[model samples]
Target: MESLFHPTGNQHILDRIDKLTPIKLSEWGVMTVSQMMEHCKMPLQVVYGTKHIKVNPLIKLLFGRRAKKQFTSAHPFGKGMPTAKEFKVNFEPDFETAKRELKELVEKFSREGKEGIKVTDHPLFGKMTYEEIDVAQWKHLDHHLKQFGV
Candidate 1:
């Protein structure tokens, strides 16, 4: 897996972010390019321990493995996939600001390295290791970048 912790892989993500424009079109989903950028930050925050969202025990027990598999698999996330409520962006977002924030968060994650990531149960993916978080984060950003054809 291409981890954001890897310098080249990290630059790949930042480059994609740089390629986005306020008027960029999405190949799928309802988010404007800016909204998608903001939405993408949610996972980083969650993994960084800056955001805490509780996962219902039953939901995690029933769907965690399946969700984890889908997220971390080589296949791109299918169009119009469901998002956790916390990750949803409702208002118009400033394109540059959103892009900058996402880029900063990505860099912060890379600096933290594997051991720096605090182990926590993902809101849906259950308990995840730093390696799992690395793969999941990269895949999530890649999916959105591809969504906007970046």
Candidate 2:
């Protein structure tokens, strides 16, 4: 699986992100390009200790392990999957600003590598290793980049 922790994969994702433009529209889903960029940043924020999500204990107990497996698997994320409310962008984001921030986060994620992740215990996915985080992050950004046809 391609991992953001590696230089090649990181550059690939950055190239795709650079292809995104203000006028680009999602091939599926409700989010505009800018909104998607903003949404993408949320998970990274959590990993970097800049954001927190409160998952219901019951939900975590019932679904956390299964969800973690799916997220870290080699298979790509399917379209129209349910998004966590915390990761959803309700307001419009500035296109250029969102793109810039997303790129910066992606770069930082790669540059710092596994040691950069500040939180390994996800609210809904339970405990994760650096490998799992890398796969999950790569899959997520790849999914969204593909969504925009970049």
Clashing pairs for model 2 are none
lDDT of 2 by residue, 85-109 (tens): 8899999999999999999999988
User: Backbone clashes in each candidate structure, one number apiece?
Assistant: 0, 0
Quote the RMSD, in angstroms, for model 2: 0.7
lDDT, candidate 2, at 92: 96
* Top-TM-score candidate index: 2
Candidate 1: Cα lDDT at 40: 94
Q: How well is each residue in 1-150 modelled by candidate 1, as lDDT tens digits? A: 688998888988999899999889999889999999999998888877788888778988898899998887777787888988878899999999999999999988767677557656777887777777888899999999999998
**TM-score of every model versus the real structure:** 0.93, 0.98
Please report how far candidate 1 places residue 141 from its true position, in Å: 0.3
